[model samples]
Target: MNLFDYTRADTLGAAVGAEGALLAGGTNLLDLMKIGVATPSRLVDVTRLPLTRIEEHEGGGLRIGAMVRNADLARHPQVLARFPAVAEALLSGASAQLRNAASTGGNVMQSTRCPYFMDPLSPCNRREPGTGCSAIGGETRNHAILGWTTGCIATHPSDLCVALAAFDAVVEIAGPSGTREVPMATFHPLPDANGVAPALAAGEIITHIRLPDPGGMARHARYVKLRERTSFAFAIVSAAAGVEVAQGRIVNARLALGGVAARPWRCLDAEAALLGQPPTEDAFARAAEQALEAAAPSGDNAAKIVLARRIAVRALSLAAAGTPDRMPALPASVFEGDVHG
Candidate 1:
């Protein structure tokens, strides 16, 4: 690893003003540093800043500090009792030890786990823009199936992001320009004609994440992850589904997909299809089909189109039945030998 200067910031202003990569838990940043994928001249430690609390907002929503550890957030009584899908998504990721060291802000800011991106010799546009993407024509089974360009097809590997999208969470940022709020759906940018951009601008720091009230859909929310293995594996395709039903018909629905796009892919069309419709297998299947209509799968990842639809239907069904506590197991047939890093 390259030698670098390190400083711990005791305040948000001090942390954001420092000229280096901000470090919270070092869960992802340190790994990237050791692999030579990220070489920072200095490290700004923000874990000591006053951003570790999880509190209820004035509007009945929740405000979670960016530095809050993943394990603590996942097991928080209010989070488990209200945003069950968020809790499930956080618990489904990584291992217990890693989760304990991963911060909420760091989780969303982590780089893609694509082998090409991590390997210094490989040509990955995300790692070095204009180098071209090796995953485009090499070992692409785990690549993206939606909103990808020839320049890059990498996917964000955050389970928490998918649930945040479903809940319509907002990101609170502090930067040189002062504080600002960005909706979670718009925070992560796609690498298309618009160009690749980090969720936060340079010198910007995430202070906290704001989650809107679920409106009684908390008990009717579910997160389903389909991975090569039951544990410690990144998802091949995952779904975060939340629905509010009345008299056997859906009143509101929120669906977000992960492990299949550059960011947490929100299925607004699917949600629209579910509203006012009965929460039946047929209805769920139709919504799933509508959700995948925009998919632009690469040759090797075409299977994701089918797999994502199946997972979406299953997740929605579980949510509609108000069984967020039940974890559904994926059948072996769904694996198809496509493992994620």
Candidate 2:
């Protein structure tokens, strides 16, 4: 790694005021630096800033600090009780060691895990805007199937982001111009005409993530990630779903998909289809079809269209069943109390 000046900031103002890349957990940033994908002359360490708490919001919601570790938030009583989908999503991500070091802000801001984007010799539009995209026709098995431009077909690899989108979370940002609140749906924008993915502006720093109360849907939420392996693998297709059902009929529903879009893909059409309908296999199948209606799969990734639909139907079925025993299992090692409580 290249030599860089390092400074730890104890306050948000100091952290945002400093130049160069901001470091929180260094799980993704340091890895990118080592691979020559990211290089900074200086590193502003924001891990010590007072943003590590998970507290209750004023209106029965929850506020999670940017520095709050993934493992901590996943097991917190408030998160587990109020937003089980969030907890499940975090647990479904990287291994226990990684989860202990990853932070809420860093997790959401992580870059795509595309091989071409990480390879210096490869032509990746995300790495070098006008260089052209390698994933468009080369090794596209794991690339995006929705909201992709010809310049780039990369997908965001964040499990927590998909869950947050389903919950309609809000992001709090602090910068030189002061503070602003951005909805989670709008926080991670799709690639623009230039093919560059959206990112925090010049001096913006993530402060907190606010999750609205799920009300009755709190007890009926699920996050299902279908990866190549049962552990320590990125999702090939994943679904996060929450629904409020009354008298065997859905009242309110929220659905978001991952691993198939440039950003977390919220399915408003699917949610609308589920409302007032019975939560049956046929209903879930129709909702899943509605969700994937806009999918534009490439040659190698055409299988993902079917896989994403089946995963969505399964996730919705599990959420409607309300059976904890039937929920997907975490890794056996994670149960050792090392990462999760």
Output the number of the lDDT-best candidate. Answer: 2
The list of candidate 2 runs beyond 4 A from truth reads: 323-341
Tens-place lDDT digits, model 2, residues 1-341: 78899888898889885798989889999999998888899999998888877777877899888988898888777677778999999999999999999999999999999898999789888878888888777898999988888888888999999999999999999989889999887687777656875568887899999999998878789999999999998899999999889998999998999999778899999999998999899999999999999898754899999999999999899888772632343444443342322
Number of clashing pairs per prediction, in order: 0, 0
Ten contiguous residues with the weakest lDDT in model 1: 332-341
lDDT of each: 0.86, 0.87
Which portions of model 1 miss their true places by more than 4 Å? Answer: 193-195, 324-341
After the best TM-score superposition of candidate 1, give how far the Cα of residue 313 lies from its true spot, in angstroms: 0.3
Model 2 sits at a Cα RMSD from the real structure of 3.9
